[model samples]
Structures are given as structure tokens and as C-alpha cells.
Target: MTTARDREILRLAVPAFLALVAEPMFLLADAAIVGHLGTLPLAGLGIAAAVLQTVIGLCVFLAYGTTAGVARHLGAGDLRGAIAQGVDGLWLAVLIGAAVTVVGVPLAGPVVRLFGASADVADPATTYLRIALLGTTPLLLMLAATGVLRGLQDTRTPLVVAVGGNALNVVLNLLLVYPAGLGIAGSALGSVLAQVASAAAFVVVVVRAARRHGAALRPDLPGIRAASRAGAPLVVRTITLRAAILVTTYAVTVGAVADDQEVDLATHQLAMTLWTFLAFALDAIAIAAQALTGRLLGAGDVTGTRETTDRMVRWGAWSGVVTGVLLAAASPWLGRLFTGDDAVRDLLVPVLIVAALGQPVAGVVFVLDGVLIGAGDGRYLARAGLVTLVAYAPVALALAALSAGLVAIWVAFCTVFMGARLVVLVHRARGDAWLVTGVVRAPK
Candidate 1:
């Protein structure tokens, strides 16, 4: 029984890990393409990307909220509810993605300008943002699909989409950036095209899922109503979480503006890239936490959910150790691969050390988020995130201002997330409250 349970947990977490890793691979490829364009171009890409992350992250409730609702529906065996979320979330995604693209394309320059992008990098940032924003509609749709699949315990579709999109992006990057001479714009364009392909691929999977597992509503009206109602809090929860993240990102932008800032644009970019990579990599455990916990919640097996959480968090810790060591070990080589600039390299390599070590903290936090969400506790997820941001973001900004170097910034980063994990862990462990009747139905 023990061996079987462990194997089952691994089954959920492995594809989840792959899916999570693939999500961040998109940006890493972009960073690589931009890095070769020389420092100014790279820096510009970094600043603009930060702004873009904030924007997209703010609206991420689309994915998280949808995932939670879908998971709950599946647990209740409401196939119609799951399908309803898939369809309605898709509708919501298209509109939201379109709005972002429209707003971003026109305001790309102004947004970067607001971030205090150096005069040299301003135009490049705008160019890059414009090209990338074109694919928002499709990208948003893909997010919706992934959320639905995750909720339904199907990681295969997301994995397929991720691989296909990444392959397309690589080919497009080679052709568009090199042969076509689109510069950074080509990088952005490549990503957009790749995401479109992913979206199309996922749509097919979603259709199949409906046919195989969903409740085949006549018009799917009832499923739609229930999903929409359940999804509202989730949406609000996600949007709020995103809003806080955006605020922190904005602080990073502000900190980047210091004249004596030890961390330049490339350095900042490297840190963010490293951060994104680690967070996504560790997110595999979170994905695991989500799937296993969701399944347990669906079946009303509270004990299974708790046990799964413990194992995944430990897995998260181990994964964090391995990832962090590798990143730190590769710091020198990574710096050389991306840039030849000695000054830029020195600053970034140290930051990489900080970035890597933070993975465990981040891993725990991310996994907790998934566990809680799967348990239908998005409201708590939202609150925890907001509180952490409030406490930690200011400290980061202050440290950055005091010394525009990587050490202070990273220390702050680690501290903030560690604090977050601790708080959540304590509460969950101390409370049997999660098992109370209707707690999942109407979570606090």
C-alpha cells in the first residue's frame, strides 16, 4: 500500500514537473536570444519583460482560480462543471488576452519609458513588447486549457503543448531573428507564433477530454452557470494575487533606476531569468501538490490530501537543493555563455548563487499554494500572498536602494518567501479546521 501510494504521487508530480519546467523555458529561450544582441538590447529586453510579467501575472487568476474550481468540480464528479469551466474560462481568456495585447501594443513604449528604461533601450523594449503582445489572445487561451487539464488531472496535454510550442519557438527564433533581421522583435514574434501553435494543439486535447470525460450538456448551460459562479471568487482571488506581484515587480523596476545601482540591466535580467527558471522548476512539486491534493479533495479523502502534501513538500525541499546547487555550480559557465562582459558577469554570478538558494523557499511556497488551492482555499492563498508582499516588497526596495547590488536584493527575496511558507505551514498544521463539513464548499 505504501509503495503504491508513493508511486501514485510520483505519477502526478512527474508530468506536472515537466509541464511546470516547460512554462518557464519560454522566457529562458527569449533571454538567450536577447542576450546575444549586445548589452543594451539585452537590458532593454529585461526591463520590458519585467513589466510584461507584472501585467500578465496580475491577471493570472485566470489560471489559478480556474484550476481550483475545476479541481473541486472533478472531486464532486461534476463532469459538467469541469467542462463548463473549460469553455467559459476559454471565453474569458480570449477577451482578457485581446485587451492586454491592445493595451500593450500601443503603450509598450510608454510602459517601458515609465520603468525608466535607459534612452538607448527604450525603442528596443517597445519593439519587443509589440511583437510579443500579438500572441496574447492565443497564449491566454492556452492558459485556460492548461488550467482545465490540470484540474481534471491531465498533465499530458499541457506537456504536449509545452514541447510543441518550445520547438516552434526555437525554429522561429533561428529564422526570424537571424535570417529575417527582425532583431529583438523577431524574438518576440517567435514566442507569439509558438504560443499560437500550443493553443491550437491544446484545443484539440480539450475537445477530446470533453468527449471522453465531460458531462456533455445539451448546450452546456448548467455546467457554464455553476463554473462561472464558482470561478468568480477564484478570478477575484487570482487577480488580487497578480496585483500584488505586479506591485513587487514595479518595485524592482524602481530599484533598477538607481545611478549607483550595482546591478545593471543585464544583471537584473539575469537575476529575473534565474529566478523565473528556479521558481518554475520547483513548481513541479506544486503541480504535484495540486494534482494529488485535487484528486483527494475531489474524493473527500482529507487524510490522503494531508499525506500527499507532506511528501510533496519534502520532494520540493530535495528538488530545491538539487536545483540550487546546480545553478550555483554553473554560475561561472552560465555567465560566460550569455555574455562576454566581465563587469556584467561578476555581478550576475553572485546573484545566481542567491537565486539558486532561494529555490527551496520558493518551492515550499509554491507547493503550499497548490495544496491550499486544491483544498479549495484560494481565499487564504490570496491573503497569504498579499500579506507577504506587503511585508517583504518594501524591504527589498529599501535594500536595493541602500546598495543596488544582488546580495541585498536576494537576501530580501529569500527572507520574504521563507516567512510566507512558515506562516502557512503553522496554520495548516495547527488546524483540523480544513476537514470541517462544507469547509471545502465554502472555504475561508
Candidate 2:
């Protein structure tokens, strides 16, 4: 009973899954390489990564917003408009990236310090942060370009670029870190170079495609402003989400300090790394949902949009079940792959089991989030995100204050935080409020 819609979902999700995992693979590799440097360095990498991820995560609207916009244009049979919208997103990425790098580089040490990491961990983190901030523009460029391709229903190019970039990153990191004696800084440098190369490849693809379709390559000021306006709510939504993660990180740090063990921090980092990888892996279906939903809605096919979304939700739930089972089964040995410290490995096992149990919830949340984003419902998402954060923050802070162990903190996150998101998303998706149809989303 394989249908056209099912085939399309598989086609997009499979490659999207591969490409999505590559980013986390970058961190996984970094953890493996840096972990041997000892707990201090691994912990340092965690802090640096949190800061970097927050910046990039906040601007993800560049990708999500652009994908929705471009897909809508393409679905309406305006290929020129699709490319034009994507071009504006690219310009915004450049401008924003430059501003972020300028401001972020100088503030790296202070930001790392704000995490209250000890001097030993803070020093290396500052070094890594300073170096990695150089790649901000390229990273944003990659995000924007990836959005364009996804909207165009071409996931294969990003898959190829991600694979090549990851390969180059591993080679450079191994050479620079061990052979050249650059330590943690070398890892950051390697990642930056890989990001730049990948960004260039994407830009080339997008530019050629634009030329072929007779779309203007230059920045369109009005279009850029419109894109910004459209993305504003998503930006707020993303901020709230990132804030939730930051709050969770802070709680973890506090709990670790209470336990008086660096292993706790290192273990939390490892768990977060695995969780991130799993999140993206599960998001493959969501990526498909975003693209297909946008296209269906744009073509004024409300029935098709509803049917596709219903199917994707079921797919997401089953995918989560399978992923959770595998992760739970792998819990014992998973830590050894990232770190050599027996303490970190021992502590990470149970924490991962707790994380594993949450995957099913995460799967549904990711899909519904994507569905809403594709339907251009950012305003509701932003408001819901704010409310969820408001509700979860106090519980997380209280747990940390009670000196709950890492396991308890994760339980609150998995059950309470994710549960809250699921409730809101399910409520939204069950309605016709987000089912508006047209090339352009009707303003809320």
C-alpha cells in the first residue's frame, strides 16, 4: 500500500536524516577527540558548544522561515519567486552572521565565565569559542542555502555536502589536534574550515539554480524586510526554546557543582550530545512535514495537506518507538564511544535510559512543531513556546535547588518540559486554525 505521498516522505526523510545527523556527528567526533584530553577539556567543550549552539539555534528561523516561504512560492508555480525569497534569506544570514561574530568573539570569555565553570575548564572553552565564532557567517549561509534546497524538494545536495564536510572535518581535526599540537583550538579550527567549504558548495548550487531560473542574484531590500518580518515570530519561538535548553544546562551545572564532581558535568555533556543527535535523527520526518505541508497548502490542496500531516504523525510516533528501543539497548556501551573516563561512562548509562524513554514524546513534538511552522503559524508557536518555558523553568530551578541528581533533572525535562510542548502542539494541530491555504500565508 505504498502511495505517492508515502514515497515522497521516505525520499525526503531518509536523506534529511543523513544530512541532519552529520552536524551532531561533528560534535560527537569533537567529544571523542577531546574526551581523551581529560574531563576538564571535555567539560570545556560542552560549555563552548552550548554557547555556539545557542547562537546558531536562535537563527534557525533563517532556515525554517525560508523553507516555508520558498516552498510556498514553488508550489504556486513561481520558481522565480521561490529563488528570490531564498536569496533574501541569504543576505540576512550574511548581515546577521557578521554582527554576531563581531559581538560574540569579544564576549566569548565572559559568556563561558557566566556558566560558572572553573578556571581550568573556562580557559580552554574560551579558546575554542573564540576560534569557532569565526565560522558564524558560513554556518548561517549553510542554513539559508539548505532551506532553499529543501523548499525546492531536493534533499540530495545537502546530503552530499554534509558527508563531504564531515569527512574533511575529521581529517583536519585529527591532524591539527594530535599531530600539530593545537589541542582544543585545533578542533574548532577544523570545524570552521569544513563549514566554510560546505557553505561555498551550497552557495554555488543556489547561484547556479537562480541563474537557470532567471531569478535575480542580488539582494532585494523589500524582500529581505518581508522575510525578516515573517521570521520575527519564529525568532521569538526559537529564543524561548533555546532559553529552555540554556535553563536545563544551568540546572545541570548547578547539580554537578552540588555533587562536587566534574564527572557529573562531563556526563551531562555526553547525554546532551546524544540527545541532540537523536533529536535531529527524529526530525527527519519533521523536515518532510515542513516541506510537504508548505507545498500542499500553497497549491490550495487542504485535503492533501491534512492527509499528509496525519500520515507523518503516525510515522513520527513509530520512528520514536524504534529509536527509543535501540537507544535503551545501547545505553551501556554508548558512553565508552565518547569518553575514556570510566566515571563518565558509568554515570552516562542510566541517564541515557531516561533520555531514551522520552524519544517517543520528542518525535511527536518535533513533527507537530514542523507542521505548524510549515503552515506559517509562527505567532501561535511563539506564544506557546513562551508559556511552556514559563511553566517549565520554575520546576527545573526548584529541582536544582533541591539538589536533585542528574537523573531527576532529566526526568523533569523529559516528562514535564516535553510533555508541556506536546500538549500545546497537539491542541493546535487538531484544529483548522493553521489550515489556511494559498501561495502566501494569511496573516494572523
Candidate 2 lDDT, 191-240, residue by residue in tens:
99999999999999999999999999888888888888899999999999
lDDT per residue for candidate 1 within 1-444, as digits (tens), equals 557667876776778778777887778887787778787778778777877676666556556656766776777778776766667677767777888887788887787787665677778888888788888888778877888888777777788778778978888987898899988888998888898889988878777767776544244445445445555555555554445444444455566655623236677777777777777778776766665676677778877777777777777778888888898899877876666667778888887887777776676767777777666665565565556667776676676566455556666666674666557655764476544221144221
Location of the lowest summed lDDT over 10 successive residues in candidate 2: 255-264
Clashes of each: 2, 0
Q: What's the TM for model 2? A: 0.98
lDDT of 1 at 57: 66
- Among these predictions, the greatest lDDT belongs to 2
- Identify the runs in model 1 with alpha carbons over 4 angstroms from their true place: 212-263, 436-444
Error in Å for residue 92 of model 1: 1.7
Cα-based lDDT at residue 114, candidate 2? 91
Q: List the residue pairs that clash in candidate 1.
A: 61-238, 75-298
